[model samples]
Target chain A: MGGGKRRRKLNAERSGRIAALPSAAPAEEPQAVTVADAAPDAPKPVPRSPYEGLPARAFWRSGVTEQHPLRVADLYRKKFALSPSHQIATAGSCFAQHIARRLKGAGYSIVDREPAPLGFDAADAQLYGYGLYSARYGNIYTARQLLQLAREAFREFEPAVPVWRKGERFFDALRPSVEPEGLASAEEVTAHRAAHLKHVRGMLKQADVIIFTFGLTETWEHRASGTVYPTAPGTIAGRYDPAVFAFRNLTHSEVLADFLAFRKRVREVNPTVKFLLTVSPVPLTATASGEHVLPATIYSKSVLRGVAGELYHRFDDVDYFPSYEMVAGHPSRGFFYEPNMRAVANAGVDVVMRAFFEAHGIEAAPRAAAEPRPKGDREGGGRRKGGGKRSKDDVVCEEMLLEAFAK
Target chain B: MRLCFIGNSHIVMVKSAWDEFAKSHADLEGEFFAASGSKMNGLELRGRSLVSDNPSVVDQLKATSGGRTSIDVDRYDGFVLVGLNLGLVNVLRVGQDHRTVATVGKAPFGHLCSDGAFDLAVKRQFDAASSRRIAEMIRSVDQKVPIAAVPTPHASRGITGRSNQFWADAELLSARAEQPWREQLEDFIRACGVAFVEQREETLDGRYFTERRFSVGSVRLRGMTERVEEEFRHMNADYGALVLQDVMPHFGSAA
Candidate 1:
């Protein structure tokens, strides 16, 4: 008999004797039987290793190489269930807009504390940073940026410089792109930021789930106050001075600590709120770090991924969604990127959302009706055209402006 | 001088007032085209004629214009588009819920909006108005034909405690919110290259409410012969006569 058959016979005999033991009895200690204990008729007992009964997922040959990428079953098991009633607030990098749109489209209750003004169409509304997130804080690229926003929202901290200027227009230093044209005066920027913070407070207080996508580890921050910005100062409006601004490539511990601090701050107002974390799969547009952009992106993403993993393991309420792996990982075979290999194709977003909805058992709702154009004007205005696919201009990313400076 | 008055339901008062004026003044001729609500949205410039395909609107146009199915642009010296969903009252309603840095502390309950954003929204509202579309259509047909656009008249008095509570909130707002928008409307109309006929100041209670005497027995646009007492939106012939007098001079006609 082969070793396999002999092992099957031994397994069956062992189970039969174990089942026959009394329910209250202690487990018997293994006796050191020599060759005398072996049955006379049985072939030498096969030596069975612990890996004998492991599932197919435990082995790379069966787990990955043999399975289709889309059919990678049990890839995600949701740590917590989300119902339609949950008031989900989403904010992160530009990629998180896809998650927000998908969730809102799925009939989940998305909190829009800073909703676009009534009668404003979708395109102009998005340009003004209204519908992109719950409170229009705009692309929060780093954990430190998020923590800073929360602190500012709660009035616990104030940045050294709250406003930045370009020509005659002034911008909020924290979320500079929110007002593309900028405000007329520094006072206007301050007032807008104040009002925005009030709504941010309301959003944090009301949300049951806060879905934040960890986008980058590299950031530009004020040297003195440690106030991190979503983009480098000069990328949008403010002047970039090396004396005042410093480039930071955040380490694993720093990113993890920033998130924990942010989590704690939010919990002060909302004790029971759950966190859903994701890492944006998009690579860096340009890296200020002397390292080549390729390795810089990998380092940034790896650090963010490591932090997510640590948080996922550390807390019961914190859940990590592998959107980064879904899009950037080799399983998709580079099929999910645009020709430039930077922007995520819509197909990739669809795949990630499909997996997300499947795991949560949420059926897709009918797609939203196309936005109506501004009355009497068939053209012009910031409205989207050409079917419903988001064009390249659909997402507003300040980081992409960094490439303009590259030689 | 020959002029054409075009608009939605609110044009009825202007037409009624013009008929009374034309009975005494023989030198001026006024042609009127009226469609109720958004029916006028279908009216477009096809070649040099302003026309529509909707049968009811066509019938109404024929009835109002002495059997003419469409207005020939070359025939009219000027055009006055009245009550085509353009108004400043909407600014007041929006202000009740949102305030700019200029008015933030004053309206404590309202959400704060940047002054620039609020200004853009106000401008966009005017840009999307149906009255602007009509002006554009007429301009495309005949750029030199002087075009004057009139906003919807203020809500009538005694609308305060009734079903029209929204007007009351607007009425309570001060001139701080009202003056800037009125200026914006003028600038917007001038930028469109159309003349703006300001609603008669004496006829208004504040900026948003017409005197009860002028609106007491306003007539419906469809059945122009009888007056409807419950109507607080349409003005009477007396109120219209005053506005028409202000509108005719823009056409270089004094009637």
Candidate 2:
């Protein structure tokens, strides 16, 4: 008990000494405390030094300073302007789909990388959307899986059995099809698959800029084969072998290596292809990690962020976009994602796109007030007349006007 | 404070509200868990596998608490669990359908009926039951945390044609209606021991629907450009603002 008491006293004394170190120098030099305090209640007989005013300025500076600025809008505009001439390839998370969609809508040349038949009826397309690519129909969850897919596709390894009918053909199956009135013939399906693969390779060879969204570092893999399935095999259609299947939490180094390999492969296909990478801001709805859900989100996001940082530092062509930071790390609570999980706020997208444009000196087109909504009508209402209401538009506009006037 | 959430989209709205409200008040910190298309019976952990195939959520929880075993139950001041009709009704459907049909191995689960539509309905119910079971399991793991169950939303305007049937019979089935779901979800949550914040009826102030154009992802989901100036309009007047106001006062304050 005496020893414990002594230890506590020592700790208190040490803490006091640590705290007194900064003040001691000022005390000896007769520093101004009132100005130093800077509080509204502090004495105001004398004006603070110019350097003293810097704390508030420094605080504001800290808030806005960026380690790197990869303008997303500039990239979008450059990609869009070059779209007519260059075939743009997009792969990665759902956000990648957005880039592709925007490019396609703007009448640019976009390679069809998705396996599903595009351009089907809205209802039928929604159903097919659930089954495209792999089960979960989404891209591989980890960078390792993405690299593996690119490698496998490049190698053209024949499977034990063809996953689909070899000679099937489907209209626009290789591209986004708007109509889904009927099922494609077996021959059409096969033809479309082959055409799709060829198109993907061609796009990789010709792409001026490849936009990839690295989603999560957590993945489930086949232990024996190292095959990374998009979803757990059973969740979609593939067979799950417990003996060969294991979950992996990809490390920063592993993710960096995969990106390096992935970049090399892209260059091998098209040496001029620049890579733009972004982390998806969407949080996982659930996790199998048997831990509290919130912490799992942080763990996955942090690892991905680390990987992005490492890759950005190592390669000059590789740039990072702040989509994840813009939404998930926005000054305000993110109001982008829909309640039903179907759509993200268009306004949020607009903000990031605007930032991208401003940095690149590209004139941004006015966002359509009646921007289309997603399936399930998650946004509640349809559209607004005149202009839709946004909580921050006025503040943003005011700030912009002030900056312009100051300039 | 320890808080739990129930229902689907309605619960999500509440979460969004709380998220925004909490940002302004530094004194309060809280967490919310909401499952889309989830039901009450799905919360149960016993007699079934509750382990999610998606490891993100569990991994998040583990990381937040430092480790799996170190989940600080005492730090939570309250718990809220939202329960809607979908979970309960679906659990009942699973039992009823399991005995009535013998589709052999044709159906993956024994509870599904032979007809396609009926089978889809059954599948929907089972999904809800599973969600409830999961919720219950979460509660079981942390008994000290309070739980709240919310009901599904009711049909309002905007839903037309065959889709209207889903919302008409709220007691029988929890349709995809946002309003009814919010109301029932709030009631159930209160019953489950957490303080309730109601929003459905209050959310619909004075807005009405009209045709308009709207986009999703890169695809245009609704493009009625010729007929209407706006793609869609609020069916209620004040829109969802009232619910936000009602819940704002309770935020960061004691239950």
Candidate 3:
């Protein structure tokens, strides 16, 4: 019985060897082809290892550190300096406002391209979800959607209003749910939208630098019109047509394509403008998609990151700033934001700004230690006034009064 | 004299006290830039503007002033900063779709400040080496005018058991638990060189009960008002009384 078993094992091993021989024979063909190709003019293929050996010199010592090298703040500062003379245009998620605020604070010119009226406060306009770049009234969920909005706005057939009229700031139709008593007419709204689109196009023409922040890859779109809305239409204010509304999760390829298209459109109008893109550090407030919250956040961020990488590689004039890295990178773990709504911490913003200044070789101002108050002047001794009770009308109109009267 | 209060709900109680005091005086001029859930960061009032994004109270002040040149600073005679414990603010939401859980911590959206991006950012703001930018703005408006920084109030007495577990859960955090929410409040008050009022100690001494306990006292059994009144008196003597004294000058002048 043992002899019979040994014979059977020998036979199985022989068959296995025969089976492997055919695979090896096929592999040899590539070797033979390489050897044949190596003759004379044909270059010899260099053998490479997956892990390359360390260079003879310490390449890192020259300037690179072991840590992740690029920082968002530094990039922003460098770009800010490089494009000092450029007219800036900003739009994207919440973080996009950061660029606008920074640029405005730094005294760089941001094109007055909002589709609102002159008297409309820019800050208030933003609260109503206007003034941000893109035509879907704020439907800028990703770089691609922003490009699509820009394209559609620029290509409107009837031209609801002239594309480039001066003194137009708000789109009356898209204004927030303020009291309807003083609202503009529908025609005025249409006209404002047209004028706003025109201003955006003109701004595109004038801008030497367009800073766009990539906020999220998830977006809700109108299926029929292919129009994207900022929040789910109902999330903010707008007509929601369930049949027309659809959720979309943008892929990296789609983002890259949209970015490239956006660049093309910008170049078509203002050939000399450069693009600087940054991923927003703000996290998702809530996810509508079915994935786990953490995973969803990761996926959304990863897609944006990939898009940023692809665009940076493809375009020499376009640069990517690692704002996402600065805030959410593994080392930092999201410390720059406050707890509740993930508002970026004041210190976090300062860190980003400081890096920006350092990278650009600009001097940073020093901060004085917060001074402690004298002990003799404690609270109870001080007299209090002006905290008075008011009528209901007074209470109701308080915000309005403050808005109108407060400096 | 115009006094401006920049703060959140902790100032609500102060506002209540001030309102009561004002009823008696009837002649003071003041304005409050206070909202129910606002921060020194100006997160609620500023929307997407720099005021909302700035981490430093000084930065928020600058942004609210609409740049350095626009801040008259002299318009107000006194500045009272209340409730600087940003850690207590609810800034981020966690969990899955439809079952999302909201928590307070640094870096509400992404992990920017949670990871340490804010430290670097703060360093950058301070590194500018010019205290005058912010200090001058404050002084220009009210030279010799006192600036008061009020510390954060303590948590109510009733947040216990599983409810309190949410405070330290990995998925979310309260701003109070993270930074010097309490300490920073004290620091802001101290730094401003005004009368400092520490309200947490009194509030923690069974004065402000949680919603659960407050409900129980109000509904369960009879004769609960005595206990409640006792707690209120304790808080008044410990916390409210101090606040009243701090702003006595303004009160007297108004009267």
Candidate 4:
């Protein structure tokens, strides 16, 4: 609670600080009137550039390439430190799953409220989206989706499109992937979703560290309620209705606004909660902007990175990890992506996670991910590493839905 | 016919029932070879001789049966392994999945889905039961002796005082669909070379929970930290009486 209150105070004070106005360039002085006595009132000192006397990370030239082959591990000057006992809950994209798994493996308390009951194995639990996050809300990709989910989980918002029917079985439109097989009836879906929301509510209140990895900027919104769906309607379970649903690629400002509002809501419920934000490094599977896919990926990632920066700057409880910069940066030389290019290679994910631990002062030796193959084979989706599980997280991108009808 | 009942804290309920019933039925005799909680896990099978090292459990059994340390396998005609886990935590953990979350107070409940996955999960918990150690210890002593396992009973349906904590986490019992779980468990216990004693139909609220009248409070438990409050997991004499009624015919006929 102190952390959140202090964050609000610091943020208020930051805004209240006089604008760091740039010092005006000196005009040629009149030689005769140069005496300090000329002006009746003394001139105020111009603020020095905020960059003055800052660390290498504050400057692009020294912080990035000059350090050559960038070390983004220390990229996170963490605003809040996580103790081993802190209950961490995460939800975002597939990359967010990696963060939860990494934190869990590192002996952090990942509060899984709705864990798959006893006899379920790890893989099946993940398939049904149970063990993947704190709750069964699956990979939340967009800022709007994250916002909508928090609202729904807290009972603050209820979407118009609650259930999507397919012949007989009904799916909770918000998290269609959560139940691998659709639920039996709309009533069953509603009951299960309520239980899920109760779990989410408890988890949000209990969590000390809320880790969210920003993935895609694009989202499909239900026109009537503005409900953000993780994937397009027809992509996963529900049928697409062009008249009812619309596509949105959120701008940096919109993303930042959504997160700020989200931060406000969470602090209302859990003022002590700290946030760890990261921009996903994996490239977009496809984009609807009609631009070249490469540039579209850049635009999406850029918007997310900008929001991450703003949130990190504005909130005392928020810190951004450069997982995006770590893998996608030129330093790694595209060595971390699989042959598919869209899927990030496990070696790349390993480097990203190692830096996460390194930043948080956690020991990296506990990693069973050590002792690996050549770390830099760009064409190495072959003989998939990290066994089948890691590959599952990689190859399955909900955005791949855009390519379902590719020429 | 003479019989021996060995278990953990859960058997306290069954033993109370059996002892009470035996008083009325002069033809039957029973002995308790069970321990409480962790003590049961430590049971040793030294050369086909099942034994407990807990002094308290041993002292109580000695007082009950006139100081017999090891089961003279030749003496008792049949053995019923009770709580030693065949009756406790694991059963309830698996069984919890089968109960519906009840909203109404004192209302009946049941599991809607009785598919293979649910049944398989329950059966697996049974197979992996820690109580199986006690059963195996007995079997090692005498290969042909009949051993019946009573899964720790689900808690009473009328846990009214702590309903908030109880309903939030606990699962309630259900009827028709509960049979597949029962059948699968029977098959599993049968495969383990032990007779499966099905719970009685008399006291059950509706297959998922038993009536409050059959519930036993924590005062009956051993080795538990003294609690000001009572635990509703163990059952009463009426419920325990039904256990002997369920298994007595088989033990009586065979012995």
* DockQ per model, Cα: 0.40, 0.01, 0.01, 0.15
TM-scores, all candidates, are 0.76, 0.42, 0.43, 0.65
- Candidate 1 — which residues are off by over 4 angstroms? A1-74, A241-243, A365-394, B1-6, B15-19, B25-79, B137-147, B154-195, B201-234, B248-254
Residue A195 miss distance in model 3 (angstroms): 1.7
Error of 2 at B164 (Å): 49
Chain A TM-score relative to the true structure, per candidate = 0.82, 0.62, 0.64, 0.79
Regions more than 4 Å wrong, model 3: A1-81, A114-139, A156-185, A363-407, B1-255
Q: In model 3, how large is the Cα lDDT of residue A2?
A: 100
lDDT of 3 by residue, A5-67 (tens): 989977986877644554332231122234555667767555342112333122333223433
Best by TM-score: 1
lDDT (C-alpha, whole model) for all candidates: 0.76, 0.44, 0.46, 0.66
RMSD of each candidate? 9.9, 26.5, 23.9, 12.3
Please tell me the TM-score of chain A for candidate 4: 0.79
- lDDT: which is higher, 1 or 3? 1
Best by lDDT: 1
The sequence of per-residue lDDT tens digits that candidate 4 reaches over residues B1-255 is 788877666766666666567777787787776556646566577765666687776765565445677666667888877755453234445434343333222433322222333444555555555567676667666778887777777667555346544343344323322554566556656655887776667666654666666774433556433422356667665666677777766675521
User: Residue A107 of model 3: what lDDT?
Assistant: 56
Clash totals in order: 0, 109, 89, 7
Q: What is candidate 3's CA lDDT for residue A259?
A: 84
lDDT of 3 at A264: 88
lDDT of 1 by residue, B40-128 (tens): 87787888888889899899888878798897888988888888877775455555566666654423444677665666566666566
lDDT of 2 by residue, A305-359 (tens): 8888777777777777767777677452556656633235666666666665554
Candidate 1 C-alpha lDDT tens digits along A137-188: 8778889989988898899999877899999999998888777778889988
